[model samples]
Target: MNIIEVEDLTTTYNGHTAIKNISFKIEKGEYVCLIGENGSGKSTLIKTIVGINKKDSGKIIKNIPPEKISYLAQNNMIDLNFPATGKEIIMTGVQKHKCLPFYKKEDYKKFADVCKLLNIEDIINKQISDLSGGQRQRIMLARALIRKPDLLILDEPCSGLDVNITKELYNILNKLNKEDGLTIIMATHDLEEIKTIGVRVICLATTVKFDGDIKDWKGEM
Candidate 1:
C-alpha cells in the first residue's frame, strides 16, 4: 500500500521555487532515504509532504490519518536552559484530552515503550541543559515516537552528531523499520550512511533526480 504519494508537486516562496515537479510514493512498510545536496529542495519537499509547507501545485495522497503521521524536522530548536527534564519535554508530544488528566497509566506506558525503543530511559530524567547532543536527539525522537505514528517523516535527523552516535541512531531507525514495520521517509545528506540499509533512494534537486533501489542509484557522490 502507498502510504504517501506526491505527483508533480511544486512549492514556491516569494516567487522562488524551492521544489518543483517533485513526485514519489512511499510504501506502507518501506524505508526510504531522501538524498540531495544543500539547497536541493530536500527540506522543502519533506515539509510539503508532512503538511508543514504549502505546495504550489500537484497532488499529495496520504493513506493514513494526519494525526498518526509523526514528523521530525532537521533542527532541534529547544532551549537548553528550559529547566525541564527530558521526559517532561517529551510528554508535551501527547495530545491533550478533556477527560484524560494529563498523564495516565497508558500514557506513561507509551512513554516507557518509546523510551525503551530509543534506549533513552536512563537519560530521560536528566535536565535538558545537562544532556548531550545525542541524548537530546533521542528525546526528540522519543517525542515523535510517543504517538505511535504509522508514518515517520524525518529531515536530516542526524546533523551535528559524531560518527559513532550517528551510527547508533541509524541502527535504531533500522531496527524500527525492519522489526516494527514502521514506514519511514527520511531526508539526509549522507547517502553512504544509509545506502546499504535495504532502503530505496529518492534524490531531489528541486525535482526528482533519481528514484530506485540504493544499489541502483548511479549518481556520483
Candidate 2:
C-alpha cells in the first residue's frame, strides 16, 4: 500500500516558493531517495512532508499516523555538545508517546534494541560531547530508531561522515529496510549513494523531475 502521497504540493521559505506543484507516492516498506542539485528544494520537500515547513498548497496524504513518522534533520541542526549522555538523548524520543514523567520497561528495551542494531551500545553511556563523528551519527540514528517508527525520514544523513562511516551508516540503513521492514525516505545529493542502496529515486527540482526505480534513474540530479 502507498504509505505516503503528495499531490501538487507547494511550499515556501522566507516568503519565496521553494517547491511547486510536486506530487508523488511512497509504498509501505519501500526505500526511496530524494536527489537534487543544491537549492532545488530537496530539503524543502522533505521538511514540508514532515511538517517542519508548511505547505502553501496541494495535499500530503499519510496512511500512517503522525506519531509513526520519525525524521532525522541535518547534522548542523543537532548540537552534540548538549549536556546529556547518549542514553539520555535517545530516551527523549520516547517522550512524545504518552507524555509520562517516567519511562516504562518497554521504553528501555527499545533503547537497548536500537543500540544493539546500530552497534552503539558501547557509546550510549558516554557524554554526547565526547563521542567521535561516526559515533555521534550512530547515536542520533539510534535516537530516531528508539521511537519504533514505521517510517524514517532523513535529510542528508551522511553529511559530515568520512568514507568508511558513510558506508557503515548505509549498511545499517540497508539492514533496517531489508531485514526489519521499515519504510525510509532519505534526501541526498550523492548519485552513487542512490544507486548503491536506494530502491526508488524521486528526483526533485521544486517539483518531481523523475520518480521511478533507482536503476531507471540516469544520473539526472
Candidate 3:
C-alpha cells in the first residue's frame, strides 16, 4: 500500500526556492534513500513530507495518520546534555498516545521491549551525555521505535559516526525494514555507501532528478 504520495511538490525558505516540482510515492515496507549535496533540497523535501516545512505549492497525501509517523531529526541539532535518562527519552515517544498523567505499567513494558530490541537496555539508566556515539544513536532509535510507528524517517543519521558504528546502525535499520516490515525513509550524503542498503534512490537538487531502483541509478549530483 502507498503510505505517502507527493505531487508537484515545491518548498521555499525566506522566499528562496528549495525544492521545485518534485513528485514521488512511498509504499509500505520500502527502504528509500534521498541523496544529494549540502543544499540540494533533500532536507527540504523531507521536512515538507514530515510537515516541519510547509510547501509553497503542491500536494502531499499521507495514507497513514500523522501519529503513525516517527521522525528523528539530525542529532547535531539536538541537545545531548538534557539531563534525561535513555529510558526517559524513550518514554517521551508515547506522549502522543492516550495515557494517564503518568505512564502506565504497560507503557513501561513497551518501552523496555523497544530498548531490548535496540540492545540499549544497558544504557537505559545512564545519562544521555554519558553514552558513547553508537550507544546514543541506538538510544535515539529506540525512542523512535517506542511508539511502534509504521513509518520511520531519519535525517543525516550517519553524519558524524565512525565506520564501525555506521555499519552497526545500518544493520539495525536493515533488520527493522526486512524482519519487522517497517518503512524507512532516510536522507544521507553518502550515496555510494548506502546504495547497497536502499531499494529506491531519490536524488534531489532543487528538484527531483532520479527516482528509481538503486541498480539503475546513473552517476550525477
Pairs in clash, predicted candidate 3: none
For candidate 2, what is the lDDT? 0.86
lDDT of 1 by residue, 1-221 (tens): 89988899999956799898888888899999888888888888888888778999999999998768898875466677889898987887776442454787888999999988888989998998899888888898998989888899999998988788889889998988988899999989767678758689888888888999998888963
lDDT (CA) per prediction: 0.85, 0.86, 0.86
lDDT of 3 by residue, 1-221 (tens): 99999999989977799999999999999999998888999888889889899999999999998778998877666688889988878888888966666988988888878987878878899998998777888888888888888999999887888888888888888889999999999998766567767578998889888889988998776
Taking all chains together, the TM-score of candidate 3 against the true structure is 0.94
Minimal lDDT window, size 10, model 1: 93-102
Q: Could you tell which candidate, 1 or 3, scores higher by TM-score? A: 3
* lDDT value, residue 193 of candidate 2: 64
**TM of each candidate vs. truth:** 0.93, 0.95, 0.94
Worst 10 residues of 3 by lDDT: 190-199
* Reference-based lDDT, residue 110, model 3: 86
Best by TM-score: 2
Models ranked on TM-score: 2, 3, 1
